[model samples]
Target: MSPKASTRVARGIITFLFIYLATPIVVTMIYSFSTSWVKTILPNGLTLKWYSELVASPEFMAVLLRSFSLGLLTTLIAMACFLPVVFYANVYNPQVKSHLRFITVLPFTIPGIILVTGLIQLYAELPIPKIIILVLAISLLSLPLTYQALDNAFIGRDFRAMFEQALVLGDSPFKAFVKVIIPNIRAGVLVAMLLTFTSAFGEYVLTNLLLGGNFETLKIYMYRLMRSNGQASSVLTTIYFIFLAFISLILILIMQHYSAPHKSTKEGAKK
Candidate 1:
């Protein structure tokens, strides 16, 4: 194909895909604002009552708080468990990364239902809090994303030399890593944390099964609303979609902010 024709074809395909994926989200957003949408091609009337009711409820606030806590704790635990391991695997023993690949497919292979069943069998009678087990399990599930992001941060950079130089300059190993290595990988860490947090926030199966609905997070609440009130459920779903879009916007901004410096340097070198 000619260059112009190929460009037009690519743009056409992209536009079609964008609309295809966005249609359901658009309909849901509209439904959330509609007074009624039954057996009709379009909504009966538009109103904000659903959103107002959802936002005004104390239960909604509690659900948000619980989900936020889950997301934050899961992110922290995932980072604590994986950061050092990924750094060591990447900077010192590259061979270990081969074994670590198993983690990437862990969720697929084991599945949440099986994992939860095992947890129930193992820790059902234990004195340990199920909340602790829930947090740890969610963290473990998020590890593959955290590991890959941290490992990629080590690429094209001599982190070992940086660490050694910092150590030689009278910094302790932990201090050296915090000061020298972390700043360089801050963007990747942020990306990993965001991904981990999002995964843990929307988690349904494990949270519902493990906590037995005593700890109702956002997803569980949404499910409850879905069975009783469709309008409220739509509103919650829209809010969740907005939250994910906000996260994606942050990721894009972080990528652009980091890439701009490299682009400028490349142009300067060429000049």
Candidate 2:
């Protein structure tokens, strides 16, 4: 094929893929407000009744809150655990970075179904809280992406210059990290936070398997009830998507803001 034709074909394929990916989202959103609930064609009209019913359901409401709390906790813990490792890998030891990266990505390469099954058997033998176990399981899935994002953001950065800049201005290493490196990669941090939280929040398989019917995240709740109440399930899914999308948008906005030239201001203070 001619280069021009190939380019056109590629664009067409890209468009097709986007639409294909988006089809389910659009349909679900439509069904969230769908009234007729049943038909060969589209719903007769949209309504808010499904959402009202969803909000009134106590079990799902609690699940939604639990999911949020779990996601937030996971994001915080993952950042605490991974951030320093990323800095050390990038600044002090680039040679071992490859191994660290592999460790993060390994979980993803393993089939989740198999992993969850293994976790289920393992958790059954432990004395930990099921919710905590489930949260950790989901966080493992998100850790690699978070590590990569922060690592990528700092790839071309000069840590020595950053440290010097902070020190001259009266900053300790801890202060420098908090004030300099963290601020510089605020975008990446925000991206990582949102991505990690979303991954943990929406995770269903691990939560279901590890929690073992003892608890439910929002996704688990949605899955359990979707069969008996399609419209209500659709509404819950829509609300979840909306909330996730909003968080994602805020992350995108943070990235845009930090993309400009910004200096590190957190140095040389009271340790």
Candidate 3:
């Protein structure tokens, strides 16, 4: 095709994609506000009753809180466990580097179904809160993400040199890590934490299979009831979408901050 035709085709494709992706969100927003929307081209009337009902439901609140806690706790533990292990392997234990790749890839290698089956079989006999099991399982999936983030943080910097320099300057090894390494990698760490929390919050299958109704989360709660109450479900969805979008914007800002130093270094080299 000629240039004009090619440009028009590209624009048409892009426009179609935008509509394709946004159609559900627009339809749902309309449905969420509608008093009655079934069997119609447009909603019969608009009202805030669904949202009001959701806000008043203590069950909904509790489920949301549980989901929030799961996300927060999972991120905390993933960060704690991955950071030091990565630091030690990079600086003190070079041989462990080869093993780390195999460990990180374990989550992706195993299917969730098989992993959960083994977990239930093993832990079904053990007496512990199923939520804890779910947390650990979810954290396994998050390990690679946080690991790569920390790895990127250490890529251009010398972990051993950084620590030894701090030692010469009269700082403990731990203090050097906290005072120097952390500030340098802070953005990557935040990105990893936020991504973990987001992934855990949206996770459903493993959670549903293991914790189920015993420890209600937003995902489980929605699965059990959303189909029965379309209006309410849409409202909850819109709320969650807004919340996730807000968090995503924060992640984007952190990522920009993280890349800034690298970008400046590249520009200086080019100069």
lDDT values for all models:
0.91, 0.81, 0.86
Query: Which pairs of residues clash in candidate 2, taking residues 3 or more apart in a chain or in different chains?
Result: 170-268, 171-267, 171-268
Instruction: Report the error of model 3 at residue 143, Å.
Output: 1.7
Number of the predicted model whose TM-score against the real structure is largest: 1
Q: List the lowest-lDDT window of 10 residues for candidate 2.
A: 262-271
What are the C-alpha RMSDs, in order, of all predicted structures?
Answer: 3.6, 4.1, 4.0
Compared with the true structure, what per-residue lDDT tens digits does model 3 show for residues 1-271?
A: 9999999999999999999999999888888999998788988999999999999999999999989999999999898889899889888997998899889989988888898899989999889777889999999888888788777777777878888899999998889989988877787788888889988987887887786678888887776668689888888888888889998999888777557756647756988
What is the C-alpha lDDT profile of model 1 across 157-214, one tens digit per residue? 8898999999999999999999889988988999999999999999999999899679
After superposition, candidate 3 runs with Cα above 4 Å error: 93-95, 261-271
TM-score of 3: 0.90
Best by lDDT: 1
Ranking by lDDT: 1, 3, 2
| TM-score for candidate 2, residues paired by index | 0.84
